[model samples]
Target: MPVEWVIDQIKAPDQSGAFSYASGAAPFCEIRLWPNRSLPARGFVFFIAATAVMLALPLIAVLGSPVWWGLLPFILGTLALTWFLLRKSYRDGAMEERLKLWSDRIEVTRIEPNQPETSWSANPYWLRLALHPNAGPVENYITLRGEDREIELGAFLSPDERTDLYNALESRLIAVQARK
Candidate 1:
């Protein structure tokens, strides 16, 4: 399907209240200026730490034996896996930039390797945004829901951005509901 463009221009609060400009031109989908929350650096650090531990296992094991030869395959395998994971994460991040909004519909477009773009839509009136808090020491995911469908956005934004997006979404939902 053709991609629609949506732009959300967040304006400072006036005498009335904080208002957002949501506009869509032909062929352009809807855009919402969501608070941009980036993924935490700690998560990356943890991942790297975990990866380092795994990568060190074979080397440590080989230290006392002739099994150092095994390090070659392990090194190569870990490199490949790490590359794949990082690439997948980057692609997922890129796909989250486009969104669609309608009277009773919402759609999201994202990119993947073989599949560059993916789209999903739902009933806008009944749709809800769900914020799932991360357990332990990780950041949470902000999910938009409609019936059984859920889309996670703002995964790579900073904390401040996440709060802004959350507030913006709440305000938008209120505005949309009040119009009806």
Candidate 2:
């Protein structure tokens, strides 16, 4: 998960000590969520090296043979296809979602590789977060219900991450309610 950053806004310094939910978070918001990524810096380097080595073994054995020439194009094509697919997947996976929960309103920002960034908002009082562990196209499906429409969140996250996000959201909402 390539989650970018989080911003936490507190209600007030004095109020925080007296109340467990002192984060005037309800009347206002201070929550952010980001998507998870599977690959890391080291993994990418290892992956490319392994791919190259695996693809070169047979070619090396046939060096100087006519067969090597015959197989060259096919081997090169396979490597090219692999590289293209991995790059495409990485691009497609470059997606992120941010949720901001405030006392009066809820806002979400979604950023994708090719599409323009989008945002949505709803009343905090009317905001509802739902998680469908098995009912949607993806596992651990999660969606946010607002006044007029419902928006999905964490779709780019893994199952476990989605579940964790749900828990965190649930807690924030509860704290906001407690403050109100």
Candidate 3:
């Protein structure tokens, strides 16, 4: 799963009554989520190498002929285009969402490649998780409704993952509320 529990520790305040993590007290939870990357860096290299080999295999028969020169530019262009597209995909997949929960507040921050970061937060008491099975843009869509706005959560996740996240968020919200 791409969902990770970045911080799930409960640390007591220092002697002066200050928390060590962010601007919150003890018992804070932070969750980081991202879309799955099916291709790793090594896999990317292997794929490009295999593609180049395959593309070159057909040119071997024409190695010493004028036809090889005529087709070489097209083959190189195709390989370059493929590399460019895959690199773009990797960049697009760099998006991530971080959700932080405190005893009194909950915040969700989204960071996407080449885009401004967006954040939403509200008191845990007033937050609500809404799960739409079929009516949302995606099946099993999850959204958090705050006092003033509603923001989507894990929209890039699969339907099953979104359902699991909804349940997990509900339980976490309950736990946060109980700590008060």
Candidate 4:
């Protein structure tokens, strides 16, 4: 679940009964919906190291062979490409969609790698969580609709994850509406 959603209750005397959902990357000062990374940095390093060692083994026997010159670039290029992609993935891993739901309003904020934060808001009473199992660019795409706007919720999540998110959001919104 690289995309995550969490609900928290506001506990201050003035804001009693207010509910918040920190989805994506909201500051932990409250709660946040954040990414559940499938690969850790350490694991990535270990895997790359193992791969490099394995790839180097056969090449060691071919050292100084005329073919080695041609093979060397391909080997180094492949490793370099792998390292670049892995580093890029790690760099983008911090991207998140933060959704905050309170009694009166629902706000969604997105933070992407090296990008400015973008946000959308709607009244909780009028907000809708929609799941299009066959529509959009991906399967089980999820979107949120407000009175005058609509936005995708978790495009980074897998289809199964989007389904889970849809169910949780449907329930949470209903609960918040009821309490309001």
Q: Whose lDDT is greatest here?
A: 3
* Candidate 2 Cα outliers beyond 4 Å, as residue runs: 1-5, 9-35
Question: Compared with the true structure, what per-residue lDDT tens digits does model 3 show for residues 5-52?
Answer: 887654422342232224556536788999999999999999999999
* Model 4 regions lying over 4 Å from their true place: 3-6, 9-31, 34-36
Best by TM-score: 3
Q: In angstroms, how far off is 117's CA in candidate 2?
A: 1.1
Q: Give the deviation of candidate 2 from the true structure as CA RMSD.
A: 4.4
For all predicted structures, in order, the TM-scores are 0.48, 0.80, 0.89, 0.79
- As for TM-score, the candidate ahead, 2 or 3, is 3
List the candidate numbers ranked by TM-score, top first. Answer: 3, 2, 4, 1
Which is better, 3 or 4, measured by TM-score? 3
Ranking of all candidate structures by their lDDT, best first = 3, 4, 2, 1
Q: Give per-residue CA lDDT, model 1, range 1-180, as digits (tens).
A: 122225543322232222212333221125543322254457766776687777777687668666777576777688668867765675554444566543334666665445656667766568787665663133656778877877776565665565666676666555544543
lDDT of 3: 0.84
lDDT tens per residue, model 4, 52-133: 9987887888899988887888888888999999888878778878777675678788888899999888888888789999
Q: Where does model 3 exceed 4 Å of error?
A: 9-23
Reference-based TM-score, model 2: 0.80
TM-score of 4: 0.79
Q: Give the Å shift of residue 19 in candidate 2.
A: 15
